[model samples]
Target: MIARTKIKPVLYHVVAVLLGFVMIYPLLWMIMSSFKPSNEIFANAGTLLPKKFYPSNYTTGFRGFGGISFSTFFKNSFIISGLSTAGSVFSSACIAYGLSRLRFKGRKIWFVMMLLTMMLPFQIIMIPQYIIFNRAGWIGTILPLVVPAYFGGGFFIFLIMQFIYGIPKDLDEAAKIDGCSFYGIFGRVILPLIVPALITSAIFAFMWKWDDFLASLLYLNNPSNYTVSLALKMFSDPSTQSDWGAMFAMATLSILPILLIFIFCQKYLVEGISTEGLKG
Candidate 1:
């Protein structure tokens, strides 16, 4: 019986390792292809190792398509993602605090409306948003991508609300007794306690904004203002020869930032998600 138990755990771990490899095989294939010469990439698609390590893929890819360098794309992506993440985290926290603590007329209605927004698909509002931004003269600029983040997204607001609800009302009452105003209570009492959840929100916001290709494609008309996602897409053309090696190299580079962010914040991310569940 003990031998069977030991064998069962070993069998389970073996299965899990095999499943993990299967899931990650494509990513591994891409990384390997990034090191291969363009000609050998398709020929050796079934293998995970390149016959000859070609370092020039990174160099050629970084030079970028057209006259614009990838440095510009990286810079633009950083600016848009950083600003959007800041706006989303702060605004969501504020809106969530109000919904959780404040009592007013139509407050429940407003909360319900906020929840309803999450149910509405982005495709439904995409055209309307484009028309609104176009009329506002913001189409060619990063404003369309960055500005809406300050208004608080539904998922983020809900995530933060769940965290806020976990806090004790006595803390708010104590702050009130200490002569703290609404803003002061939020800033002093609740904000410090919700750090894990805030980090979770920031990580999510950064990843979403960084990987957003569709919005960047639609709003950004200038090649010089293209983001990493757009720049990578420019490497391929159906009618002509595509730089598969360079595209793969750039694609690998593009995921590094998000991977680093998740690695660093993974502890807080797990904490926030687990604790938030206790409230709702």
Candidate 2:
């Protein structure tokens, strides 16, 4: 058993090292390719490392979109993502608190309905949703992408509800005994205990909004309104040519923020996932 356990750790470390290379290889490729000239991109594709790294591709990528700058796209992405994430996190937390910590009629039915929505694919309602937004004159703008976030999303709701459930009911009851209202308990007691939950929900919400491609493509018609994901589109031109180096550079830039967010919030994410039933 001791030998088996010792070998297990060795095997795990070996597997982890292999997986790390697999995960990081694409990023290293992107960084290297971004430095290569457009011609060298395909020619040196097999090479793991570039002979010389040039910073010009980043400059070219920033200047790629006609008159529209990378900064504009960055700002638009930031606004849309920030608005949607805040709306989703706050509304989801409130819903989760109500569902998990409070007793109410039809609660189970409501939860079932919420879960049912998660099972439904976006494809099912895409066309109808597009039409509705179009008629409301919300399409070709950021509103369509940001507004639905206010209606707590199904996955986020479930995520926060699970965290809220993990919090002891006795804590809430104790707060009540001290003459606290629902809002007071949520604000003073449960809220403090669920920092892990909030961080988890925020991270998920930010990631979802950050990497969102379809919704941005659907609603943002104008080039000026593009997100970082859409920056890759500009790297292609059927009439003239596509710049692979520039495209790869932009892709690398788009990946970094999401990676950093995960790095910062990973601790909270793991903590939030640990299941502990309410004590009441």
Candidate 3:
């Protein structure tokens, strides 16, 4: 029985490692190919190491197109992502707090509507949203992308609601006895306790906005206003030659911020998700 138990765990670990390698192979290949020359990238595709480590891909990619540096794309992504994340986190927290703690008429209806929205795919609302934004003259701007976050994202609100539900009711009662209003209790009692959930929300919000290609493509027509997604596209042209090496190099660089955020906030993310599921 002891031998079987040890062998089972060993087999499980080996299988897990193999799966991990398989999942990460594409990313590893891209990173390795970024160091190869454009012409050599395809030729040496099967190999993990480059024969000649060409550093020009980074420089060439950063040079960008039409007089705009790749830095502009990175900057725009940061601005859109930062504001959107802040708005989503704050609005979601506020809305979730109300939904979880405050008693009001038709609150259940609102909650149901919110969950229903989650089931509704973005494709269903894309055309109407485009027309609305076009009428508002925000089609060529980032406002349409960032402003909606302030309204509270359905998934984020739900996640935060679950987290809020996990908090003890005793804290709210104690705050009430101490003459705390709803806002006061929220700010003083609940806010500090829900840091993990907030960080999880922020991490997800930032990563999603950072990687968003469809919305960026729809709203941002000007090359100067393009985000990283658009800039990456510029590196390839089916009608002509493509800069695959530079594209891979920039793509590698683009993932660093997300990787760093995940590394630092992973602990909170896991705790928040697990606790929310268990307690809620």
Candidate 4:
């Protein structure tokens, strides 16, 4: 029995390690290939290690196209992601608080509508949204990308509502007794307690906004306003020889912010998801 138990754990760990490596292999391959020469990338497709570490790919990719540098793309991505995330988190928190804590007629109906919006895919509304933005002269500006985030995303609101629901109503009642208004109670009492959920939402919002390609492509027609995702797409040319090495180099660089955020805030993310209803 003891021998079988030990063997079972060893087998489980081996399988887990193998599966993890298999899942991450593509990312690893891409990182390794970035160090290779453009011509040699496909020539040694099966090999993970480059024959020589060519750092020139990073330089070439950073130079960017049409006189616009990769630094500009990076700055634009940061601006959009930062503003959108801030708007999403703050607005979602307020909306979640009202939905979860307040008593009002038609509350359930409004909540249902919000939940239904989550079920609708972006493609269904894309054309309508584009037409509206075009009419407002916002198609070529970041306004189309950043403005809507201030209205609160359905998913973020839902996540925060669940978190808020876990808090005892007594807290609100106590605040009321202490002469606090609704807004004062929300800012002073509820917001401080919901830090985990807010951080969780912010992390997700930032990562999604950072990696958003289709939205960036749709709204940003000017090369100067292009984001990292858009800039990466410009690396490929079907009619000519594409610089695979530089593309891979920039692609590898693009994921660092997300990786670092997850690594640092994963504890809060896990806690926010798992401990919501358990809190009194």
Which is the leading candidate under lDDT? 4
Candidate 3 structure quality by residue, lDDT tens digits, 1-280: 9999999999999999999999999999999999999899998778988998998999999999899999999999999999999999999999999999989999999999999989998889999999999999998899999999999989889988888888888888999999999899999989998888899889999999999998998899999899998799999999999999999999999999999999988999997776553242
Candidate 3 regions exceeding 4 Å error are 1-9, 276-280
Which candidate do you rate higher for lDDT, 2 or 3? 3
lDDT (10s digit) by residue, model 1, range 1-280:
9999999999999999999999999999999999998889998788899998998999999999787888899999999999999999999999999999989999999999999999998789999999999999998899999999999989989988888888888888989999999999999988998988999989999999999999999999999889999889999988998899999999999999999999989999998887553331
lDDT of 1 at 252: 96
Where is model 1 more than 4 Å wrong at Cα? 276-280
1 or 4: which has the higher TM-score? Answer: 4
- Give model 1's clash tally: 0
Task: Order the candidates by lDDT, highest first.
Answer: 4, 1, 3, 2
**lDDT (CA) per prediction:** 0.92, 0.85, 0.92, 0.93
Tell me the TM-score of each prediction against the true structure: 0.97, 0.92, 0.95, 0.97
Clashes of 2: 0
Model 2, position 240, has a per-residue lDDT of 90
Error of 3 at 266 (Å): 0.7
| Candidate 2 segments exceeding 4 Å error | 1-12, 275-280
Clashing pairs in 4: none
